[model samples]
Structures are given as structure tokens and as C-alpha cells.
Target: MSLAFLLLTMGLVCLVAGGALALNVRGCAHALERKAAGNAELAMHARGELGQPQLVMSARLYRCLGTVFVLCGIVLTPYGFLELA
Candidate 1:
């Protein structure tokens, strides 16, 4: 009804979404890790056996998104709760 309540709802939604996203990302990262291990030579040959840039980037993006969503939830929840009270 109120702004605070809305924020609280939004924040909770973000938290749930973020958590789900993070889990999916984690799975992807795990898969990439396995893939990279399989083709380490070619995947990292250009970079002197460093790592696969695409996989790394994908994992990073997911991680960053997850963090952002969770942080959003963390930042919004308290304000919403306090204001609602």
C-alpha cells in the first residue's frame, strides 16, 4: 500500500530472484570449469594457459548480477521495514 511496503516487497522479490539466479550461475560456472579443464590447452593457449576468456566472463557476469541483486535487496529491505513501521 505505502511506499515503504512496496519497497519491502520489491526487496524481498529481489532477494529471492537473486538467490535463484546465483544458484543457476553457480551451476554454469561449475560446468565451465569442467569444460575448461577438458580443453585447457586450446582454451588458454593464446593466453599462455591462463584460462578461457568467454567462460570466465560469463561466470563473472552472472556473479556480478547476483551480487547486484542481493545488494539491492539488502539495501532496500531495511529502509522499507523501518519506514513501514
Candidate 2:
């Protein structure tokens, strides 16, 4: 396959991976909130100065995946352009 095709394929893969990560993170956050809601202590703790560990971890993962996707897209664009040249 041509370099352009390869780049496009990789870019699409990154986007899909990032989307999946984001969805997973959102799901986890919701679940954690729901679980914490049942326990007043947990809910209070989550709302206090210290945030929910699970939610924070999930957000970090989502952020990392999003950054990777963006970087991949940016890199692939140049590669695709070069291939066309």
C-alpha cells in the first residue's frame, strides 16, 4: 500500500482508539459517581478537597489517549502529504 494509505489508516485507528478510551472513561466516571452516591461518606469524600481516585485516573487515561490521537493525526497528515509528493 502507498504511504498515504498507510498514514490514513493509522490516523483512523488512532481516532477509533481515542474514542473508545473516552467512552470507557465516561462510563467509569458515571459508575463511580453512582456507587459513591449510595455512601454518604464516600460522596462527601469525593466532593471534599480530595477528588475520586478512580475518576481522576480515568480522566488521565482519557487525556493521554486524546493526546496520542491528536499527535498521530498531526504526524500522519505530514506523512500523507509527503507520500503524495
Candidate 3:
């Protein structure tokens, strides 16, 4: 009983976290992109046409991770219910 309840709670937490991240996906991506763009401009100014690598966090990474978390939560919630059954 406790195990099932714990699983359900964990699942709910994951779902909520993933949902929040998904909601901010666009804004996060845009901010990262802007930062990268600024870095790129600086690189071009200093590197004389040679491009320097910028560490940019891609929006896709957040989306994929959030998707994974949501999927885990969805699977877990069902299993938690099944445990009660």
C-alpha cells in the first residue's frame, strides 16, 4: 500500500515538473538562442571569420527530456493504479 502510494506520488511529481518545463520550452529556447547569437557575434568580432563553437542549450533537448519525464509519469501512474487493483 505504501509502495503504491509512493509510486503514485512520484509519478504525479514527474508529470507536474515535465508539464512546467514544457510550458516554458519556447521562452527558454528563445533566451538560449539569443545568448548564443550574442556569443556568435563576439566570436566573429575576435576570430576573423573563423567560427568559434558556442555552447548553446538547444530547445529540443528540453522538449525531449520533458517528454521522457511525462512518459515515465504516465507509465508510472498507471502501474500505481494497477497495483491497487
Candidate 4:
């Protein structure tokens, strides 16, 4: 029972972190898009390389965090059962 509760708490924490990270990454992309649109030189530079790449990297990182959270939940679930046994 204690293990179950612990696992649940950890799972919730992971889910929250994943969600926050995902939202932050999306917000960053939206902000960048808006910034790029306002100035032609900025837009051209954004299109050239660096700007889009960073956004993509951040998005991938969030995706990885979400994946890790899910995996941790799965792992903890079985471990919780073992603890009960």
C-alpha cells in the first residue's frame, strides 16, 4: 500500500513535469514565430538555420521527458506490486 502510494506520487510528479515542459517548449516556439514575423531580417535569419533548429531541439527534449515519465510509471507499477508481495 505504501509502495503503491509512493509510485502514484512519483508518477503524478513525472506527468506534471512532462506536461509543463511540453507547454514551455510550445510557448517558446510560438514566441519565436511571432518574433520572426515582425522583422524581415530576423525572419530571413530564422529561416536560414539556428532559430528553427533550437525550437526543434526543445520540442524533442519535451517529447523525451514525456516518454521517460511514461516509462517510469510502467516500471514503478510492477515494482509496487513486488513490494506488496
Best-fitting candidate, scored by TM-score? 3
lDDT of 1 by residue, 1-85 (tens): 4999899998999898776666765486456555665665575676676654544446556656877898899999999988978
- What lDDT would each prediction earn against the true structure? 0.73, 0.62, 0.76, 0.59
TM-score of 3: 0.61
Error of 3 at 18 (Å): 0.8
Candidate RMSDs in order? 6.8, 8.1, 5.2, 7.7
Per residue, candidate 4 scores C-alpha lDDT tens digits across 1-85 of 8867787677666656555554665575345444445565565576785443223334456456666776776677666666767
Show where candidate 4 strays beyond 4 Å: 12-57
lDDT of 2 by residue, 1-85 (tens): 4878888778777766655554655575345445544465576677783543443334455556666776777677677767877
Show the lowest summed lDDT stretch of 10 residues, model 4. Answer: 50-59
lDDT of 1 at 49: 62
List model 3 lDDT by residue over 46-76, tens digit each: 8787665565667667667777888899988
Candidate 2: TM-score? 0.44
How many clashes in each candidate? Answer: 0, 0, 0, 0
TM-score-superior candidate, 1 or 2: 1
lDDT score, candidate 3, position 71: 86
Q: Estimate each model's TM-score.
A: 0.57, 0.44, 0.61, 0.42
